[model samples]
Target: MPRPPTMEDVARAAGVSRSTVSRVFQNGGERVSADATVRIHEAAKRLGYVHNLVASGLALRRGRQLGLLIRDATNPAYGHLHAEMNRAVQGVDRQLISVTASRHDYGTAEVEGLNRLIGQRVAGVFVGTGVTAAEDLVETVTATPMMIVGRPNDHPQIESVSYDERTHGRLMADAIAAAGHRRIAVLTAPLLYSRVFDLRMRSLAERCGELGLTTIPVDLLPVEHGVARALDVAREEALSCIVCPVDFVALDLLRAAVARGVRIPEDVSTVGFDGLGDGLDLLGLATVRLPVAEVAREAVTRMEALLVATQEDAEGPPPPGGDQGGVDATARARHLVIPGRFLPGRTLSSAPEHLRT
Candidate 1:
C-alpha cells in the first residue's frame, strides 16, 4: 500500500519552504503570489498530498469547526433552520458538529458536553434551543464566542438572532379581528419547548385587547398529541379561528377542524408560523414565513466574528467594555430586531357574514 503524501513531500516537489506549503493549504498565504498557490496545488496533486484539517487546526490553535447545539430536532421549524445552518457553515469551508440536548432534560450533563466542545477548541457555537442562562455554561460560552437562535433573551457575551415573534403575534390577532372574529383561541404546546410560541401568544393577547376582541387559551397536549387535542378544542370553543405556533400544529388543527365538519376560512380561519412545505401550500394556511436561510447565514457570520474577536482579546488588551464586552452598555445598543412578514393564504378570510359585525 502507498503511504499518504506529507507536507514535506509537497514542499520538496514545489521547491518551496514547508511553511509556504502550509500557508497555501490553509488559505492564509497573503504574501505568497497566485503563481505560488498554483504551483503548490499542482505539486500536492502530483504527490497525493492531502491536507489534514484537524492537524492544521491543532497547529493554529483555531479549529475551523463549529458546534451546533439543538433541542427538538424533530420540529420542522428547527429542522429547516438546522439544514440551512449546516449549508452556510460548509459554504464558508467550515465543518459543523451537531449535538442534541434533550428538551426536557437540560441539566449539568448538557453543560458539561458543551464545555467539552469548547475544550476541544471549536471556533464558535450556534445554539438552536434548550440552552438558557446557565451561569457556568454562559461563562464558558461568553468566554469564547457563541450565538443563539430562536430565543429572545440576550447575554452579555452571546449574540442572539431570532425573528420578532411579537410582530408575528400582533399580525395574527389583527387578521382575526379584521375578519370579525371576536372569540378566538390559540392552541400551543408546553411553554418549556415553546418559548417562541409564548411570545407570539403574548403579542396576540395585547393586540386582541387593543381591538376589543376576546381570546381563549387552549393548551394542547404535547405536540405529539396535538392533532387530537386541537380537534377537541375546536369543538368545545366553537372557535372561529385557531392560531397555532407552527405549521405542523396548524396542519393538525386543519385536519381536526375538517373532521368535525368545520369549514376552513369560511367557518374557521387558521394561522401558523414557519411556512415550510408544498403540502401546506395545498392547504392554503395563512402563515408567517421565517427567513430560515437568512437567519442561518447571519447566525454563522456572527459566530465567526465573535470567535475572531475573542481571539483578538486573548492576544491583546480586552476591548473596551462598551465596545467588546458583549454585556457592556454599547453592546446592548447594538441589539437587532429582524421582522417577519405575514403571508396571506387561503386558510384565513373574513368570518362568515353572521359572525361578522
Candidate 2:
C-alpha cells in the first residue's frame, strides 16, 4: 500500500504550512482562519488522512481523553448516558473515546478494549452499562482512574455512579402488591450475568414474598428461548402479572402475550424495569426509570477529580497494577446511588378473581 498521507501533505494540499495543519487538527482548529480550517479538512479527507488521537496524545505526553466502554451503544437504554456523557466531555474541553464489548467474546474482548484505551493514554474512564463484566480486569485497569456508570458495583478500586436497583425493585414489588397482583411471573436473566439484575431480583423476590405474592420464576435462556418460556409460565402458573427485570424482555413477553390474545391488565398485568423502550405509555406499562443524566454528570465530575489527582501524583510511583488506591489520597471514591423513579401506569391492576386462588 502507498504511504498514508501526513499533516505535511494536508498542509501542502491546503496551501498552508505543516505547523498550521498541526494547529488545525490538534487544537480544534482554533486561531486558524475559517477558510484555512475548511481547506485543511477537505484536503485531509481527499488524502484519506485519519487523525490518530492516540498518537498525538502520546507525542504530547498529555491528553484529555475519557474512555467509555459500553456493552451496546445501539441499545436505547444507554442512549441518554451516551448523549449526556458526550456533553459532559465537551463541557470540559476533553475528548470522549468509546469501545464496545463483543457480545460473542465478552471476556477477551473486554480485556482488549480496556487495554486499547489505556494504550491511548486516556486521563480516566467512565465505564458504561454491562462493562461490569470487567470486574476480573480490575488489575489491568487500575493504572488509570475509573468510574462505573449505568450500574452498581462494590469494587473498591473504582468509583461508581448508579441508581439503586434494590430500591427500584422494592418499589416495583410494592406497586404490584398495591395493585393486588398476588400471582406474578418474574422474568429475568441468570444471577451471574448481571449484578444489577441480581440485586433487583433479590429485592423484588424478597419484597414480593413479604407481600404474600406468588412469584413464578421465568429464567431467560441464551438463544432467547426465554420469550417463549415467559408465555408458558404466564399461562401455566396462571400468573396475574408479569414482572420483568428489564424493559426489553418485558416488551418481548408483552408482544408474545398479546399475540396469544392475552388482554393486558385485564387478563394479565405487566411491569418492567428501565424506562428504555417506547410505546410503554401507550401500552400503559408500569416500569422503573433509570437516572441516566445524573449518572452521566456524576461520572464526568468524578473523572475530572481523578484526572486532577493523577496529575498531582505524576511524580509518584506508577499506580499499582491492581485496583489498589483507585481513588488517590487527594480524591475520595464516590459511590453515588440515586433512587429510581417508579411510573404507575395502567399495566398494574387488581388480580383477576380466577387467579386469586
Candidate 3:
C-alpha cells in the first residue's frame, strides 16, 4: 500500500516546521508569515499531503484542569513543590498541567502558556517564579483564577504565595559573620537576575557589612568548571568562607575546595541556601531550608478556590501531560510570606586565625 503524506512532509519541503504547518492550518490561531503560508501550500501540492488534525481532535478531554508554570523542572526544590501540588489536584480528581521553560524563555513562554490555557478554558493557574513577568500575568488571569506560587506581584488581579527570602539571606549572612569570617564569597546561580535573587544578595551583603565582614559576589561557573573557579576564588581572595545561593552550587564549591587540598572548616568553611533532603543530610551542609511543602499547600488551596469560582465561565480544562495557565475572577490580590529554618552543620566554623584579606 502507498503511504499517505503528513505535515512533516509539507514542513520539510517548505523549509519550515511541523508547528509552522500547524499554525498555517489553524488560521483561527497563530499567524504564519504569508510567504511561509504560500510555501506550505506549494509543498502540500508537490508532496500530495493533506493536513489532518483528526488525531488531536480525538484526544481525551480533561474537564477540570489546573495550570502550573515553573523553570528548571529538574531542580529538586521546585520538583518537590510541583509533586505535592500534583498529588493534591489528583486527590480531588482534577488534573494539573504544567509548562517548564528555561530562564531565557521566561518572557515568551509565560504569555504564550497563559493564552493556551485560557483558550483551553482551564479553571485556574499556578505560576512559579521565573515563569514570566508578574504584571503580565496579573492582567492575563482576569477570566480564570490564578495563584502566583513562589512569586510575588503588586497587581491586584493575582495572589502570590512566597517564601520570606529576605530572612533567608539574613540568616546565612548572620551565620557566616557570627563564625568570625572576615572575607566571604557569594557563589550565585549562573547569571540570572530576579527580585528574589536581588533581595537575597542585598540582605546578605547588608548584614555582612554590618558585621565588618567583606562580602563579595562572584558568578558561579557552570557545574563542569565550577570547582576550579571556586578554588581559584578562595585562594586568590584569601576568603575564610564560601556562601552559596543554592545547595547544589555549595556542593560544587565544596568538592572543588577539597580537591585543591583545602580542609572544610579547618581552613575554610561553607554555607548554602535551600537544605534539600538527601543532599544536605549526606553533606551535613549548614543551610537555610525553604518551606516548599507549606508553599505548595497554600497555592493549591488558593488556586482551587479560584477554580470553583470560575466554573460557570470556564471551559473544560487543558488535557493533562504538560503545564498550562487559566483565568479566574475569584482570585484576589494577596501576598503570603513564610520564613526559612536554619540547619547547622559541620561545614561551618569560626574564621581562620589569620584571614588572608
Assess every candidate by TM-score: 0.72, 0.76, 0.70
Candidate 2 per-residue C-alpha lDDT over 189-236 given as tens digits, one digit per residue, 9 for 90 to 100:
664466677789889999998888888887765525776777678878
lDDT of 1 at 201: 83
TM-score quality measure for candidate 2: 0.76
- Cα deviation of 241 in candidate 3 (Å)? 0.9
Clashing pairs in 2: none
lDDT by candidate, in order shown: 0.68, 0.72, 0.68
| C-alpha RMSD between model 3 and the true structure | 11.0
State each model's C-alpha RMSD to the native: 12.6, 10.1, 11.0
Worst 10-residue lDDT window, candidate 1: 321-330
The residue-level lDDT of candidate 3 at 200 comes to 71
Q: Identify the superior model by TM-score, candidate 1 or candidate 2.
A: 2
Please name the candidate that would achieve the greatest TM-score relative to the true structure: 2
lDDT of 1 by residue, 127-200 (tens): 67744553434544422356777666555545678777888888878877877787777775555555677788
Deviation from native of the Cα of residue 285 in model 1, angstroms: 1.3
Quote the lDDT for 211 in model 2. 86
Residue 63 CA displacement from its true place in model 1, Å: 1.5
Better of 1 and 2 by lDDT: 2
- The Cα error of candidate 1 at residue 22, in Å, is 26
Off by over 4 Å in 3: 1-63, 91-93, 103-106, 139-142, 189-195, 221-227, 307-331
